[model samples]
Target: MFLRKIANAIGGLLFLALFLTFLVQITARFGFNQPLPWSDELAVILYLWVILWACAFVVPEKEHVMFDLVWNSVSPTTRRLMRLVGHTLIGGLAIAAIPASWSYVHFMAREKTAVLGLSFEWVFLPFVLLLLSLAARSWHGLVQAMNNRDLDIHEANP
Candidate 1:
């Protein structure tokens, strides 16, 4: 889908930025004998964005870690039931945390990073996006489970 492509693009861009930041940090530290103070902070922030962004958007559901000892042993009916219960729990918890997460991110507006002086809210905003993405993904899973789709536990994507 178009949205998925955009998400992938964003994730790729974030990773590229993180790589460039590290290159800058390393080059300055060794080549110039003077490390940039803000580079470290920027790198950390970009790393966080890259990881959470990948998890929330780029990665597919089947690619995630699964304790499949039970899932693999289950029947199709049981697997559907498990999907329903699992998605419900995950989506419910993610939805429940949204308000608190938003509040904390908003409250962090006054705080700034040590070296970059970037507001904490902007730094932490990806967390909110992650939570929202989790909830949305779970909802989609729930719907698919209800429709009896994706009940089989495949070893790999075909």
Candidate 2:
């Protein structure tokens, strides 16, 4: 629940910032005789942040697009097995991504944004957070599956 709130708040704020920046840029460029050069760069960064953080919300919400036709048609035992396999795979992938993303962040830690002059590592921080959240969700799913709980075809909260 706390994670959901944080994810939503961060995503919402980033999207709002991006929208306001774009509006301001448009007003400056057209209404006034000047433009905000940093607006575009800021928007890009905000867009990245919005996407990365929103994944954490989506994973637990089961909001991501999935082919649920087969899932819905499966028998109980098959469904349980599928859930176990799916959760394991997701957990493994998230675990794998952490070190890879960490290394990449470190490799580009010295690099800065062209306009904001912020470290690239800072920009990439949300990717790590996204992976960690997904990993937690995956673990939750795995535990649920092991306990003989029926996985939802479309929705679950971790």
Candidate 3:
């Protein structure tokens, strides 16, 4: 619950920042006829953070896009098997990519954004968080499958 609150707060704050930055950009460009150099870049950065953060923390698993035709048709035991296989593949791939993702993000530290001069490493760090979240969620799903806690297709969809 605490973590959920934190995630919601972060997601809200990022969106607010992005919206404010956009307003500032528009006001400066059209109202004052003097555009700020950093506003666009800042907006882009905030947009990226907002999207990736939502994907990683804010969005519920059931809300994600899924092709559930087969899933809906399968029996509970078959669904469990599917969940196990799917989560295992997803979690395994995410875990495998973490090291390389970390290396690339670390290497980007030397590069900075054009206007903000903020390290690229900081900008791209959310990607690592996303990968970690994916793996964690997959693990959770795997565990649920093992425990025979599969959600009905109707429940998941509706």
Candidate 4:
């Protein structure tokens, strides 16, 4: 819950920052007859962060898109099994991505953006975070599904 709130706040701020930066760039380019070279790069970075963080923010809430028509028609036991299988597969894929993503991030460690000179690794931090958040959410969903199954079983017995 707390992480979701934080992700929301951060995503909002990133979006605001990206929007304001674009506005500034436009104003500076046309209104002032001067263009800021760094603004475009900054906007790209901010946009990337906003997108990645927004994804993370939605994962915990299961607000991401899914085909629920078939899901809703399934039996309870079958639904639970499907959920566990889905979450497990997703979680495993996410786990698999971590090291490759980490290597990609590190490959740019010494590199910097053209205009801003910000470290490329820093620029790609949100990608890494997105993967991590996805994994966390997947595992969390798996656990929740298991617990629900246990509760359902207990209720049936009681």
Candidate 5:
């Protein structure tokens, strides 16, 4: 529980910082006549981090998009079975994606962003985190499906 709290706190801080920086950039660009060159890329990358981290942070809350009307109408057993299939497919995709994204990031490391001179890894790191988080979340969903009793698709608090 404590660890979950810490993760939540860090996620919140990261999101807050991302938005604050974007606001600052917008203000500088419009409120004043001067705009920082790195603001656009930095804001986009920061938004990526928020979305990636939010995957782990949000799924436990059952907040991701779902076809709830359809899901609710299905028989419980069928729902569980479908859940396993869906989660398995998603997890497998996540596992497969890590290597390909990593390779692209590595290949681009020699080049720098036009504005920030940032390594491509800076952009790709969020994708790695996103995929890993999906893998973890989907695995948890699979475990719950296998249990086949009182299943909750939320990721474990850990």
Candidate 6:
């Protein structure tokens, strides 16, 4: 619960930061003769982090996309089983993605982008943490499904 609050607070700030970056970029382009070289680049990078970070906070809210038509068609017990299985797969992917991305981020630390002139690792590092957080969230969802306690679950009927 404490961790979730921290994630939410961080996500909210990141979102605001992303918005501020856009505003700054627009202001610089219009208000000044020259635009900031790294504004859009950093904005884009932060946008990615905001997205991935938002995912962790969202999963508990059952915000991920789903194929409801198929799941709705199944029996209640079957539906529950399928939900568990699907969440397990997602959790596994998040788990795998963390390590995979960490390795890539580590590799990128040795170099930096030209315009941004910042270590790519700094931008990419959050993705690893986000992926791991997602894994944790998905695993939590899987447990909720097993206990039939998930409130926002969806299913496909066909």
Give Cα-based local distance difference scores for all models.
Answer: 0.91, 0.83, 0.92, 0.81, 0.78, 0.78
Give the residue spans of candidate 3 off by over 4 A.
153-158
Q: 44-88, model 1: which lDDT tens digit per residue?
A: 999988988999999988888888899878788898999999999
Which candidate tops TM-score? Answer: 1
Candidate 3 lDDT tens digits, 1-158: 89989999999999999999999999999999999989999999999999999999998788888999999788888888998999999899999999999999999999999989999999999999999999999999998888887556347535
lDDT string for model 2 (76-111, tens) is: 788999989998999999999899888998888899
TM-score of each: 0.95, 0.89, 0.94, 0.84, 0.85, 0.83
Instruction: Name the candidate, 1 or 3, with the larger TM-score value.
Output: 1
Worst 10-residue stretch by lDDT in candidate 3?
A: 149-158
Tens-place lDDT digits, model 6, residues 1-158: 89768888998899899899999999999998679988889898889888877875644444466667876677878877886887789789888777678889999999987787889998877778777776876787788777887534643111
Judged by whole-model lDDT over C-alpha atoms, candidate 1 comes out at 0.91
Superposed on all Cα atoms, the candidates' RMSDs to the truth, in angstroms, are: 1.4, 2.2, 1.7, 4.9, 2.9, 3.7
lDDT of 4 at 139: 85
Q: Decide which is better by TM-score, 2 or 3.
A: 3
Where does the lowest 10-residue lDDT sum fall in candidate 5? 149-158
Error of 2 at 144 (Å): 0.7
Q: Indicate the residue-level lDDT of 70 in model 6.
A: 75
Please give the distance, in angstroms, between residue 110's alpha carbon in candidate 3 and its true position after superposition: 0.5
The segments of candidate 6 whose C-alpha lies over 4 angstroms from its true place after superposition are 58-61, 151-158
| Model 4 steric clash total | 0
Which runs of model 2 end up more than 4 angstroms from their true locations? 155-158
Ranking by TM-score: 1, 3, 2, 5, 4, 6
